[model samples]
Target: MSVNARRLAAATLATGVIAGLVGLACIHLLHWIQALAWDMHGGTLLEAASAVSPTRRILVLTLGGVIGALSWFLLFRRNKAITSVSAAVSGTPMPPLRATWHALTQVLIVGLGASVGREVAPREMAAAFSAAAADRLGLSAEDRRIIVACGAGAGLAAVYSIPLSGAVYTLEILLVSRSGRAVAPAFLTSGIAVLISTGFTRPAPFYTVPTLTPSLSLTVFGALVGPLLGAAGWAFKQAVARVGAARPRDWRLLLTLPAAFLVVGLIASRLPSVLGNGQASAQTQFDATWAAGAGLAFAALVLAAKTLTTFLTIRAGGWGGVLTPAVALGAGLGAVIGLPWAAAWPGSEVAAFAFIGAAAFLGASMNAPFTGLILVIEFTAQGPTILVPAVLAVGGATAATTWLTRHAR
Candidate 1:
C-alpha cells in the first residue's frame, strides 16, 4: 500500500482501540446510572404511586407526561443548532454536545412517569458519543460511521448484557435503507465495552426461558401468522403517527399532557395493576395460559395506549423513539394471542408463541426485524427455539408493513 493508505490503516486501528475503551467506560457508567434511575427511583415511585388513591395515581402519570412533553418542546424548539440521532444515523450522522444534552435531559420524563423507558434517550447518547469521538480522531466518513455503529452496539450490549445482540442491533437498525456495509470496528468496540461493564452488573438472567424445538407443521403455521402480526404492527405505527398529527392540546403539553394523565390515570387507577412499564403484566400474559377475553382486552387497550403515547410525544414533538413502548406493547399482544393459540393450536405453549409475538412485532414495527429477533433471544435466552416463530411472525410483520407503506415515502 502507498504511504497515505498505510497511515489511514494505522489510524483506523488506533481509533478502534480507543473507541473500545471509551465505549466500555461510557456504556458501563451509563448502565449503572440508568439501572439506578429505573430501579431505585422508578421502582420507588411506582410502589408509592400504587398506594395512593386512584386520583393521585392519574395525577402522577399525567405529571410524568407533562415533564416528558415539556422536555421535548423546550429542547427541540429552542435548539435549532442541534441535530437528532435519527438524522445522524442516516447520511453523515453526528452527535454533538447539543444533542448529548438534549438526550440526557429527556431521561427525567421517562424516569418520572412519562409512560416510556430510558432506552430511547441513552441509546442516542451512546451513538452521539461514538460518532463524535470518531470524527474527532480523524477517521474517514466511512470509518467514523463504522466506529459509531460499534459504539452504539457496544452501548446496547453493555446495557442489555446481550453483547451479541447489541452488536447486531447497532448494524441492523441503522441499516434501515438497506446498506450492505458492516461496522466491524463498532462490533469490536461494543464487544470490549460489554466485557468491562459485565463486572458492574448484578446477577440475574434477563429472562428465563425453556428450551424448545418446532415441529415441521408448527413451523409452517407460524410463517402464516407473520403477515397478520405485520398488519397489527403497521396499525400501531399508524396510531402513533395519527396522535402525533392530532390537533393541538389534544396530545400536546398545554392540552395533551393533562389529557394523557387523565387517560393513563383512569385506566391504571381502575386496573390498579396495569400501570407503569407493564413489563411484569405483559410477561404474565405471555405465560400462554391467561384467560382469552381478559388477555385480549388488555392487549388491545395497551396497543392503543402505547401507540397514542408514542404519537403524542414524537408528533406533538416529544423527544424519544417509540421502541420501548413498542416492545412492551408488542409483548402484550403476543401474550394475549399466545394464550389462545396454545389452547387452540395442536401442541404449543403460550410462552413460546408470546415470545414469537414480541419478536415479530418489534422487528416489523421498527423496520429492524433482525434486531427484534436478536433482542428477544437476548431478553429471553430462548435460543434456536425462537427461530421458527421468529421467522413466521417477524417475517410476516415485515412483509405486511412494507406492503402497507409501499406508496408512501
Candidate 2:
C-alpha cells in the first residue's frame, strides 16, 4: 500500500478506538449522574422521576440548570468557540480541550435530567479526538474529513450499539456520500466501535417491544401517515433551528437556563416521562396497550410535553441532539393518528403504528430516510416484515421534507 493509504487506514482504526473509549466514558458518566441525582439505580429514568416528589423534581432540575449554566459560562469565558462536527470535517480547527469539556458538559446536563438527547455528546467527543488524531497522523484533507465523520458515527454506534445505523448516519447524513471511499471507512469504524464498546454498554435492541405483526392496516397507515409526520417533522426542525440560533450566549444564560429548566421541572412534576431525552416516553409508547381513545390522549399529552421541553432546553443555552426527541414525537404522532385509524380499520396495534412513526418521523426530521429506518429496526431488534411499511413511509417522509426544504430555500 502507498504511504497515504496506510496513514488513512491507521487513522480510521484510531478513530474507531477513540470513539469506543469516548462512548464508554460518556455513557458511564451519564448513568452515574442520573443515579446520583434521581437515585435511579436500576429502573428507567421515568421510574426514578416518578418515584421522586414534585418538589424534589423541581429542585433537582433547577439545580442542574444552574450547574449547566455555570459550566458553560466558564467554558466559554475565554472566548474560544468550538466548531461542530460538520465544520471540523470541513477543515475547521477544533480545540481539543475545549471540545472535550464541551462534550462532557452536555453529557453531564443530560445525566442531571436535562430535557435533550445524549447522542450528541459522544459524537462531539469522537469528532474532536478524530480531528486531533488526523492532525497528528498527517492525513490528507479528504481523508481527514472521511475519518472524522466516520469517527462521529462510530461514537453514535458505540453508544447505541447500532453499527449499521452508525455507518448509514455517517455516509447518508454527515458526509452525504455514497462513494466507495466513504463507504468502507464508515462501516469499519462504526463496526469496530460497536464491538469494542458492547462489553461496557447496553446490549442491542436498546428499547424492547412485544411481538408486532404487519398487516394491511399497518401498510396503509404507514403510507398515509408519512406525509403528516413529514410536515410535522419539518416544522419541528425549523422551530428548533430558530430557537437554537437565538439561544442565550452571554450573561443572560444563567437566568434563562435555570428558568427554562424550572418550566421543564414544573411540567415534569405532572408528566415525569418528559424528563431526560424522550427514552422513557418512547419506551412507554412502545409498550402501550391502551385502546384507541386512551392511547390517543396519552400520546397527545406526552407529545406536547416532550416538544415544549425539548425546545425550551435548546432555547435556554443547552446543547444536545434532537434524535430521541424526534422519536418521542413520532411515536406520539403515530399513536395519536393511528388510534383513530385503528378504530376505523382494525388490524394493527397502536404500538405498531408508533414503531412505524418513529422511523418515518426520524427520517423526515433528519432528512435521512435510510438511517431513520435502520435505526428503528436496530433499536428494537425487530424483523424485516415491518420494513415494507417502514421503507414506504420513510421514502414518503423524506420526499416531503426534501421538497419543503428546497422550496423554502
Top-lDDT candidate index: 2
TM-score of each: 0.78, 0.97
| Predicted structure 1: clash tally | 8
Q: Write the residue-wise lDDT of candidate 2 on 1-409 in tens digits.
A: 9998899999989999999988888878988999999998986898899999999999899988998899888887768366888888888887778888888888888887888998988998899899899889999889999999998999999888889999999999889999998899999999889878886445747777777888999898878778878878888888888998888768888899999999999998998988998888788788775553466777788888898999989988998989988888888888888888888998877778888889889888888888888888888887386778777788788888988999999
Residue lDDT tens for model 1, 154-262: 6566655566666677777654333433555445555666566564454354544566557553565468777877777777777766765553422245566556655
* lDDT at position 386, candidate 1: 54
**Candidate 2 vs. true structure, TM-score:** 0.97
Cand. 1 TM to true fold = 0.78
Off by over 4 Å in 2: 200-204, 290-293
Worst lDDT 10-window in candidate 2 = 287-296
